[model samples]
Target chain A: MTVSVPHSLDDAVRLLGEHPDAMLLAGGTDAMVEINDGHRRPNAMVIALNRVPDLRSWRHDPVSGTVTIGAGVTYTELMQEPLAELLPALAEASRTVGSPQIRNAGTLGGNLGTCSPAGDGLPVLSALDAEIRIVSSSGERTISVHDLMVGVKQTSLLPGELIAEIDLKVRAGWQGYAKVGVRNAMVIAVASACLAVDSEQRRVSIALGSVGPTVLRCADAEQQLSNAVDWTSGAVSPDAIREFGTLVSAASTPITDHRSTAEYRSHAVGVLGARLARRAFATSEGAAG
Target chain B: MSNQFFTLRVNGADHEIADSWLGESLLDVLRDRAGLMGSKGACTQGECGSCSVMVDDSLVCSCLVMAATAVDQEIVTIEGVAPIGAPSDVQQAFVDAGAVQCGFCTPGLIMAVHDLLDRTSEPTDTEIREELAGNVCRCTGYGRIIEAVQQVAVQRGGAK
Candidate 1:
């Protein structure tokens, strides 16, 4: 077995191009667990990405109102000051991921790499309509978060391609994330939801996790709630919120699992959606997040 | 694939590890190869903080870190927390507060407490609980552990 620690994004991609079968290691939070549990083994080469500087930094485009986060940026960094202020919903999701130790080592790119439906970062990425930047020796290309995740633990990324950065647009109005788990800390989400309101576009976006194979967007629910909100007053009726929750629940195709029942997951997402809708469309200035 | 040879710098000393598996965890190498048994492996997963260590100022579960991938990084284990022969203030506080029960999870808790106090000198009870949530202790019901952290805060002059 061999391990190659590349110091730059170019070198990392080049190495990937040379060894398409090499397993990529970001923070090793998920991969190492699999290795420890005897579920996975490194056959030939392991590409460690933590040393790559380009994959560990983030940048903001003022004109585009977008934040591009490097693939190796840890969740702890995401929950900190500047990035947290820029992406509050992402920050909130980051806080709920694993523990502090896990957060210190886990990366958004790892979340995308695993592409689990229960991943805390997925709902936020989906709700924000984030784009994934992929790189290879040949060149770079972009894909939406929705398109990138094909199914459970599955992705459309071709071999020799590395996730370079995640691009999220900063939108107008409020955005927040919440998840229902068995316990408060270090618990995987049984059902999770993210809500983002773009007042400028007069649109509301909702995404659910752990209730389906992939993070699902509640398009009908979003449209119904968006149209129900009075942009001038920034108020939404309780009836609209209830209907929105029902619509969101109806969108989920959950299965009964040991962690939770499908009925519970579907119901929990509805409650989460309604709560988020209330918070987003609250009439009081300070009440809305 | 064969055993990978690498140098891991731990507690200011570089240890050359040879004939190690590529899938060996940092915790595995620290205990087996380097003979540093201070970091215990309870869950063998990140769910338990028994294998907590500081990798370049970041507290992470050593079991989740690939040993070969940590070659160039500075790794700090429980054995490196104090000076030559004396326990650190945090360790001593754990003893004075009687926070040791079975002593398996003590090392990880000590590392976590050090991290929390270093970041927030005068952390509140809620903050301390939240910060130490990762380090679980089935014994003592965590009352004495919380008391020890409060004691350390006062001893360190962070709290009145």
Candidate 2:
């Protein structure tokens, strides 16, 4: 077997472009499990991206209001960085991933590559309207998180392409994440929600995970809440908020699984969505005050 | 497999190994070749913290780490933390609190606690819980384990 370790992003790009069949290994927290489980029998080649220094660093562009995180950056790094405050939901989700060890080794890019509907990072990325940077042998391109995830265990990633980084547009807003799992730690979610509110723009975004084929946004609920609330005062009518929860419930398409019943998933999403929205609204008010 | 070789500095020692199987996990190499038995191979999955070790000062599951990737990095295992003669403060605290029951999860727990105390000398109960949440224990019910951590925190006046 050929295990290729590229020390630079340029080298990685060239290697990936040259070897389309080689499996990309980042963090290896997930890839190793797959290999051990016999779920994936990699051919003679494996591309190890952890050694690429450029893929492990992050930078913020104040002028563009964007925070670009390297694909190889681990969750533990994110929790201890300044980005924790700006992306509270994502940070919170990262903390609940597996365990301290897993968080320290797992990369955001690996989570996206898995494309699992129950992935904790997906909901928050969707809520934040995050953009993913992709690089192939030729060049780089960017796509919305919502567009990248096509379905359960599926993504828009093509062969010979690698995720370079994830770019998040910093917005003046408050956000929170909550999930219902079988256990307190090291468990997958039955249902989860991420709520982001941009009061200045009179916009709200709700992303629901584990209750559908992919992380889904509650567009109708967002629109209803945005139209009903007074953005300047950060006041959202209670009755309209209740209706927003109802719309979010209607949007879920959960299935009965070993972890939870379909009914429970739907109910949890509705309750958690409403609770998160209220918390985000409160945080915004506190910041404004 | 290629004929390339790399040197790894683990636990204050340098060792050269073939890079052909660089994709192999560090856990396997440490247990099979290095003969460092402190880090256990429990689930072989990242879910269990049994194989927890420090890579360049960051705690990570050894099972998920590639041996080649760990080249030029500093690694700290349970054996490294507690040499043959002396033990770290956290290890002593574990013994004092009666936290070592079955002992299967002791090394991982000690590493987690070590990292926590190093980062936050005075961590609150909530912070301790958050830090230890990642390390699971089936024995002692975690009550005694937590008590042991609190005892250390109190002895050092670390908890505010």
Candidate 3:
């Protein structure tokens, strides 16, 4: 159980290229939990990413209208200023993750790495159409957030590839996240949804979580709501909003888990979707306005 | 296997930990090897803040941090919050407010309160509750804990 702490991205990827099977520890929120619970045993080298300076900073390119966040950036950092203002839904989701102790150590990359269906950050990334930059000693590549998540607790990442940064466009509209759990703070999502309204594109995107094997996008609901919105006035009728919720509920493929039932999850996601849509397009002065 | 040795700087003092497993958590190293028992381990998971500590400037669950990975970081535990045999202002407030019921979650709660006040001088009720949400106290029902924090805030020049 040798531990390697690399201070640079180059060295970290190089080590990873060498030991493709090495366990990558970022934030250690999930990995450490698995280790402590004896759910996972590692005989391979452990590569810790906390010291890599390149993976801890975020850059907002106003010209490009995009923000690239390093894989090592903690949730606490995401919920703060500058980034918070730019990525509102992500910030909201970050605030709901675990607790102050968990948020202080958890990272979006860790959330992506874990790739759980209930991951708080994934639904936001999905609705935002986030791009993931993957790197290795050999080279680098980019993939959409939707493509990166292959299944529950799985990713499409190759053996040596590590998530370098998350790219999110700064859209000109209202974007928010909401989740339903037994309690407010420190509870995993029984059901969650993210709504991002792209005024420029005249599109509304919706994504659901904890209801399927992966974070799912409700294309039908999104298209329906987008079409219903009065682009000039930014007004969405109540009937449209109701139908949108029904579409979202139809899109969900939830199963009965210990935390919640399938019927409740399906119902909860619809409510969350309608509530977020109503908030986004609340009045004549809607998200576009 | 040969012993894996590393040095951790805790509370302005450096302790050398030998024969440590790479899989051991910072909580394990602190309590078992460094002999610093102030940071208690309850859940051994991040859900419970019993093992909370400051790694660098951030307050984190020590159980979630790999011990070896914290080699170059500054670790501050409950013992380091004040001089031995003396209570810090926060600790004294906890006693005064009757925040201590069983005293098991006191250290972590104290660390959390210190972290919160250090960041926000006079935190609002919402801010205080949100900041200390991680440290769950089965006893006291959190009313006294909030009182202790509010008392410390006013005493520490954090005007309401």
Better of 2 and 3 by DockQ: 3
**What's model 1's lDDT at B102?**
94
lDDT ranking from best candidate downward: 3, 1, 2
Q: Whole-model lDDT, candidate 3?
A: 0.93
**Pairs that collide, model 2:** B122-B158
Which stretches of candidate 2 lie above 4 Å from their native place? A282-289, B1-7, B16-23, B155-160
Residue-wise C-alpha lDDT for candidate 2, range B26-89, written one tens digit per residue: 8887876677888987888777687889999998988888776687689988888967768777
What DockQ does model 3 achieve? 0.66
- Fnat, model by model in order, equals 0.79, 0.59, 0.77
Give all TM-scores, in the order shown.
0.97, 0.93, 0.97
CA lDDT for candidate 2: 0.83
Model 3 chain A: weakest 10-residue lDDT segment is: A280-289
Question: CA lDDT of each candidate?
Answer: 0.92, 0.83, 0.93
What's the CA error at residue A275 for candidate 1, in Å?
Answer: 0.8
lDDT tens readout by residue for model 1, B1-107: 23368899999999999888878999999999999999999998898899999999999999999998887788999888998579998999999999999999999
What's the CA error at residue B147 for candidate 3, in Å? 0.7
Give the TM-score comparing model 1 with the true structure, all chains together: 0.97
User: Over all chains combined, what TM-score does candidate 2 have?
Assistant: 0.93
- What is the per-candidate TM-score for chain B? 0.95, 0.89, 0.95
Positional deviation of residue A7's Cα in model 3 after best superposition, in angstroms: 0.2
